[model samples]
Target: MSLIVQKFGGSSLANMQRVFNVARIVTQTYNQGHSVVVVVSAQGDTTDELLSKAYEINEEPSKREMDVLLSSGEQISMALLAMAIEKLGYHVVSLTGRQAGILTNSRYGSARIKSIETERLFKELDAKNIVIVAGFQGWNKYDDITTLGRGGSDTTAVALAASLHADVCEIYTDVDGVFTADPRIVGNPSKLRDISYDEMLELASLGANVLHNRSVEMAKKYGVKLVVRSSLNDSEGTVVKEVGSVEKMYVRGVARDNDIARIAVIGIEDKPGMAFKLFSLLARERISIDVILQSIGRDDTNDISFTVKKADLQKSLGVIRENLGMLNAKEVKYSENYSKVSVVGAGMVNNPGVASMMFEALYDADINIHMITTSEMKISVLVDVEKAERAVNAIHDKFKLGEINS
Candidate 1:
């Protein structure tokens, strides 16, 4: 029998009715002669509600304790799912991350999977039993419970697929599949039939919520095939696999990040080590900076701009202010008033006029591009938050992203 590992997001099992829906889906797959393993996140808003409860009691909760508290959500889901499957007259076993042999490093909020010894899973599968494993939580060497950061469930699902060598990893979520642009932003955005792992990684990093970045990276490393389909429908969804050749790739797709903010370090002496020193400070504090751009100075001083998550603005700005004297920057300016919009595709490097067309589209709409950063697969531009919607629409239309209406 072929092995298939499927993961369901919180939205997939938001209520009792939804939970039974998931059980039915798994039961149907099992009846079709496939060995099915299911991974599941918490019910809708369970993790968030737990976080709020913890914050109400303590302003600063210990990370280790927080993980212990948060993991309960997935545990609840797994047990409930097993019960539901049993009600459907199927033999089922549910295992937590540790029970399923998901060993991870002790990073508290963002642990990485070290190894997975699935001996028990094999035994269960051999008996024609459907195995249900909780996602987003793992055990470290010290036996301490750790939560993989946000969307870690996606990572867990893919990692398990790699370990089990399953034929495919199905990620069931609310959306039908990965789209050319967020449909809410761009009307009738096209759903890609297939995408390469590298292109998917770029899209996820650039703000596509269809899949998580860590999961994409893991999939690429292990050559795991992934499908992001909807639990609510029978759509085939987007297939993520190896690119046979770099030539067969799309030119551009929409990515928008509203959680990003711009940080401008003003009036720094135009010197080589200056940028290094500023970034070093942020690294020391464990603040992630994305999309950095440096501008030439009119005199001998330059302006350096970077983007960080809006949630980290206060702490990151404080760190910059503390190191201001060492950086020798005249002023540190921060604006939560900006957003990042990117066009991602693996073929971008050899695609002629891609950048020019992107700029021209924005230019035609009179949308000013404040900062720009490019990687092999993607180019991101920063603009005022108010103009983010306009920019996405303009680019989507310029590229003729959806099916052409001839």
Candidate 2:
């Protein structure tokens, strides 16, 4: 029997009926002569509700205690799912993250998996019992409970799949699979049958919520095959593997991220080691940066700008202000009202006209490109928040991605 790791997101198991649906699917996979391991997120808005209660009690909750309280959401779902499977006449065992041997670093909220010990899990599988593990929660080195950061469950599923050497890791979500573009944004975005892990990573970062970026990186590192599919339907979904020469899609998808902020450090003398000194200070403060651009300013000065998550704006700006001597910038300007619009396609790497077309599309719409970043399969541009929707629609239509897909 082959081993398969299946993960269901919160939306896929939002209610008792949905719980029963997951149980049926697990049972079917088990009966098909496969050892099934299922990882599940917290049921529908339960985690959020828990966080709300914690905030009500304490504006600033301890990360350790917060994790302890938040992890219960997935635990409840795991137990209920196990019981549901038992009602369907199958042997099943429910294990929390610690019980399943998910060992992670000591970070309370945003821990990363160091390793996985599946000995107990293998023993249960030997006895032909289906194992259901709570996702998003793991144990620190000291055996204290901790929750991985947002989108932790996806990382959990991919980690488990890597640990078990499963043939494929199936991600069950509300939608059928990864589409050429977000179906909601672009009507009838083509459903991709298969895509490379690189393309999928771009899509995830751009705005595809089907899988998390951290999970995709793990899957890519471990050479694990991942499938994104719908739990409510019998569709085959999309297969994500290493890119192959055989072509199936000219452009895979487009993603737009509205939660973006850009910071510009202007009028710095163009001297050696200037950029390093400024960035090192921000790195020390743990501010994540994306899409950095440096250009020569008028009169021998330089302009450096970068993007960070909107929530980090105050902290990041604070650090820069504190380290102004190190940055040596005449002024630090930031725009909180900015958005990132990205178009992802595998063929962009080979086509010289892709960049030209993208720029022309934005130019035609009179949308200013603040910062630009490109990858083998994706191009992201920053624009004014008010024009974000128009920018996406313009690029989508300019590439004629809609016409090409439908």
Work out the TM-score per prediction. Answer: 0.96, 0.95
Best by lDDT: 1
User: After best superposition, candidate 1 residue 187: deviation in angstroms?
Assistant: 1.4
Candidate 2 per-residue lDDT over residues 1-406, each given as its tens digit: 7999999999988999999999999999999999999999999999999999999999999999999999999999999999999999999999999999999999999999999999988988899999999999999878799999988999999999999999899999999988766777776466777888888888888777888999999999999999999999998899999983325444566788887888898987788998888888889878888999998898888999999998888888898888777667788899989889888777777777878888898999999988889877778898888998777777777766666435
lDDT of 2 at 285: 77
Report the Cα lDDT for residue 296, model 1: 78
Residues 1-406 of candidate 1 have per-residue lDDT tens digits of 7999999999998999999999999999999999999999999999999999999999999999999999999999999999999998999999999999999999998888899988988999998889999999999989999889987999999999999999999999998888889988888788887888988888898888889999999999999999989899898888888872346444647889999888899988887899889998899988999988888776798999888998888988999899888888888998888889999887777788888999999999999998888877888899888999999999988888776322
Query: What is candidate 1's CA lDDT for residue 91?
Result: 97
Report the poorest 10 consecutive residues by lDDT, candidate 1. Answer: 243-252
For each candidate, the alpha-carbon lDDT, in order, equals 0.89, 0.88
